[model samples]
Target: MRGSRVLSATFGYLGLTVAALFFLLPLLWIVVTSLKTPEQLFQYPPRWWPEHPTLENYTYLFSKMPFIRYSFNSLKVAGLSTIGSVVSCSLAAYAFARLRFAGRTALFYVLLATLMIPYQVTMIPVFILMRSLGWVDTYYPLIVPWFFGGAFGTFLLRQFFLTIPTELDDAAKIDGCSAFGIYRRIYLPLAGPALTALAIFVFMFQWNDLLTPVIYLSDPDKFTLTLGLAFFKGTVVTRWNLIMAGAVISAVPILIIYLAAQRYFVQGVALTGLKG
Candidate 1:
C-alpha cells in the first residue's frame, strides 16, 4: 500500500509539472519574442532569445497605440463590474440561501438554467435591447449589466452560505436583528472567503473579456486592451512582436491579481464544501 501510494504521488507530480510547462510555454515564447527585434521575430525558426534583445517592440507599440488609455478603460470597466458583481451576487446568494419567498426556488433554478445556455444564444437580443436603450456605444452596456448578478457567482456563494450553522441567524434574531441587519452583520462577515473568490472571478472574467468591448465600444479612446490589439493587424501584415508584447502587458495584471488572492480562492472553495 505504501509503495502504491508513493508511486501514485510521483505520477501526479510528474503529470502536473508537464501540464504546467505546456500551459507556460506559449506565454514564455511570447515574452521572448516580444524582446526580439522585428527582424529576429520574423525568422523562419524562432530564436529562443534574441541575438540582441530590445524594448523597441513594447516602446513602439505604446507610442503608436493608445495602450495607456486602453488600460485605463479596462481598469474602470473591470473594477466597477467586479465590485457590482460581488455585491449583487452575494446579496442574491444570501436571499436564496437563508430567506424564503414565493417562487424563490423556481426563479433561482431558471437563473441557473440560463447559465447552461451560451451567452451567444442571447447575444443579438441583448445587443438590440441595449441599442434600444441607447447604450450601444456607452460603458453602461459593459459595466451596468454586471450589477444585476452573475448566476455562477451567486450559486457558488449560496452553496457556501448554506454550509454555515443556522444557529447564528437564530441567535441574531433573538437579539432583535432585522433580516437586513443579519445579512450585513452576520452573513457578510462570515462570507469573506467566498466573496473574495467571487470578486476574483468577476474581475478576471471582465478584465480578459474581448467580445463585448469590441461589439459595444467604437471610439479608440474608449477601447480596451483587446480592442486596441486589433489595430496591430494590417491588411498586408501584422506586427507579431508588438502584439505579443501588448498581450504580455495585458496578461500581467490578471496574473498579479490571481497570485495575490490565491489563498482566498482556496479558502473559498474549502468553505463551500461542495465536492462531496
Candidate 2:
C-alpha cells in the first residue's frame, strides 16, 4: 500500500510539473521575444533566449508614446467600473436575498435569463443609446453601464448572501434596523471575502476589456492600454517586441491584484458555491 501511494504521489507531482511548464511556455516565450533585438527576430531558427537583451523597446514605447497616460486612463475606467459593479451588485443582491416583494422570484429569474443573451445582440442598441446621449467619445460608455448591476455579479453576491443565517436579519429588524441598515451592518460585513472576489473580477474584466474600448473609444488620447497597444501594428509591419513589452506591462496590475486577493478569492468562490 505504501509503495502504491508513493507511485501515485510521484505521478501527481510529475503531472503538475508538466502542466505548469505547458502554461508558462507562452509567457516565457513572450518575455524572451520582448527582449530580443529586431535583427534577431527574423532569424531562420529563433533562439529561445535573446543573445543580448535590452530595455530599448520599453524605453522607446514610453518616451515616444503617451503610454503612461494610457495606463492612467485604464486605471481610472477600471477602478470606477469596479466600484460601481460592487456597490450596485451588492445592493441588488441584498434585495434579492432579503426583501419580500411582488414578482421578486419571477424578476430574479428574468434577470438571470438575460445572462444567456449574447452581448453582441445588445451591442448596437447600446451604442446607439450612448451616441444619443453624446457619450460616444467619452468614458461614460465604458463606465456608466457597470453602475447597473450585471446579472452575474448580482447572482454571485446573492448566493453568498443566502449562506448567512436568516436569524441575523430578524434580529436586526427587531433592533429597529431598516432594510438598508441590515444590509450595510450585517450582510456587508459578513460578505467581505465575496465582495473582494467580486471586485477583483470586475476590475480584471474592465482592465482587460478590449472589445468595448475598441468599439467606444475612437481618439488616441482616451485610449486604454489595450487600445494603445494596437498602435504597434501597422499596415506595413508590426512591432512584436514593443507589443510584447507593453503586454507584459499591462498584465502586471492584474497579476498583482489576483495575488493579493487570492486567499479571499478562493474563500469567496467556495462559500458562494456552498448553498447555491
Candidate 3:
C-alpha cells in the first residue's frame, strides 16, 4: 500500500509538471519572441532564446501605433463597465435573492434564458440600435449597456447573496433599515470576495472585447488595445516581433489584477460554486 501510494504521488506530480509546461510554453514563447530581432523572428526550427535581444520592437510599436491612446481607451471602457456591471448586477441579484416581488422567479428564469441565446443572434439588432441612437464611433455603446444587469453577473452575485443568513436581514429590518440600507450596510460589506471576483471578470471581459469595439468604432484614435495590436498584421506582411511585444503589453494589466485579487477570486469562485 505504501509503495502504491508513492507511485500514485509520483505520477500526480509528473502530470502536474507536464500540464504546467503545456500552459506556460506559449507564454514563454511570446516573451522570447517579443525580445527577438525581426530577422530572428523567422529563423528555422525556432530558437527558445533570442540570439540578439532588442528593445526595438517595443520602441517601434509605441512610436508607430497609437498604443497609449488604445490603452487609455481600453482602461476607460473597462473601468466604467466594471463599475456599472457591479452596481447594476448587485442590485438585481440582491432583489432576486432577498426581495419578494411578483414574477420574480419567472423573471429571473427568463433572464437566465437569455444567456442561452447566442451573441451573434443579437449583434445585428444591437448594432442597428446603436447606429440609430448615433452612438456609433462613441464609447457609449461599449460602456452604457453594462449599466443594465447581466444574467451571469446577476446569477453569480445572487448565489452568493443566497448564502448569507436571513437572520441578518431580519436584524437590519428590526433596526428600521430599508431594503437598500440592508443591502448597503449588511450584505455588501460581507460580499467583498464575490464582488472582487465579479469586478475582475467584468474588467477583463471589457478590456479584451474586440467585436463590439470593431463594429462601433471606425476611428483609429478611439480603438482599444486589442484592435491596435491588429495593426501589426497587415495583408502583405506581418510584424511578428511588434505583435508579440504588443501582446505582452496587453497581457500585463490582466496579470497584475489577477495576482492582486487572486485569493479573493479563488475564494469567491469556491464559495459560490459550493453554495450553488
Candidate 4:
C-alpha cells in the first residue's frame, strides 16, 4: 500500500509538470521568436534562443502595421466596456441581493437562462441592433452592450452581496438611508473585491475578444489587437517574428491585470461559490 501510494503521487506530480510544460511551451516560443531577427525567424528546427536578438521586429511591426492605433482602439473600447459592465452589473446585483420585487426570482432565472443560450444565437440580433443604431464600425458597438448588465457578472456579484450580513443593511436604513443610499453606503463599500473581480473579467474578455470586434469593425484604424494579429500572420515572408511580437504585446496587458487582481478574484469566487 505504501509503495502504491508513492507511485501514485509521483505520477500525479509528473502529470502536472507535463501539463505545465504543454501550456507554457507556446508562450516560450512566442517570447523567443519575438526577440529574433527576420533571418532567424524561420531557421530550420526553431532555435530555443535567438542567434542574434533584436528589437527591430517590434519596431518594424509597429511601423509597417498601424499596431499602435489598433492597440489604442482595443484599450479604449475594452476599458469603456469594463466600466459599463461594472456599473450596470453592480447596481443590478445590489437590487437582486437586497430588494424583494415581484417576480424577482423568476427574472433571475430568466437571466440565467440567457446564459444558457449561446452568444452565437444573439449575434445576429446584436448586429442588427447595432446597424439600426448606426453604431457599426464605431466603439459604441463594443462598449454599449455592456451597460445593459451582463448575465454572469450580475449573478456573480449578487451572490457575493447576498452573502453579506443583513444587519449592515438595517443599520444603514436606520440612518435614514434610501434604497440607493443603502446600496451606495453599505453594500458597495464591502463588495469591492467582487466588483473588481468582475471588472477584471470584463476587461479581459473585451481585450482578447475577436469575434464581435472583427464582425462590427470594418475600418483598419478601428481594429482591435485581437483582430489585427490576423493581419500580421499573412503579410510577408518573415511573418513569425512580427506575429510573435504582436501576440506578446496583446497578451501582456491581460497578464498584468490578472496578476494585480488575482487576490481579490479568488476571494470573490471562493466566498460567493459557497453561497450557492
Per-model TM-score, in order, reads 0.89, 0.93, 0.94, 0.91
Instruction: Order the numbered candidates by TM-score, best leading.
Output: 3, 2, 4, 1
State the C-alpha lDDT per candidate: 0.85, 0.88, 0.88, 0.86
Off by over 4 Å in 2: 267-276
How many residue pairs clash in each candidate at the backbone level? 0, 0, 0, 0
lDDT (tens digit, per residue) of candidate 1 on 156-192: 8898899889999999999999999998998999988
**In candidate 4, which residue ranges exceed 4 Å CA deviation?**
1-13, 265-276
Against the hidden true structure, what lDDT does model 2 obtain?
A: 0.88
lDDT of 4: 0.86
Native-to-model Cα distance after best TM-score fit, residue 261 in candidate 1, in Å: 1.6
Tens digit per residue, CA lDDT, model 2, 149-200: 9888898899889989999999989999999999999999999888988898
Q: Flag regions of model 3 displaced more than 4 Å.
A: 267-276
Query: Which 10 successive residues of model 1 have the least lDDT summed?
Result: 230-239
Choose 2 or 4, whichever is better by lDDT.
Answer: 2
Better of 1 and 2 by lDDT: 2
Candidate 3 residue-wise lDDT at 197: 85
Model 2 clash pairs? none
Candidate 4 lDDT score at position 27: 86
Off by over 4 Å in 1: 1-14, 234-236, 265-276
| Best-to-worst ranking by lDDT | 3, 2, 4, 1
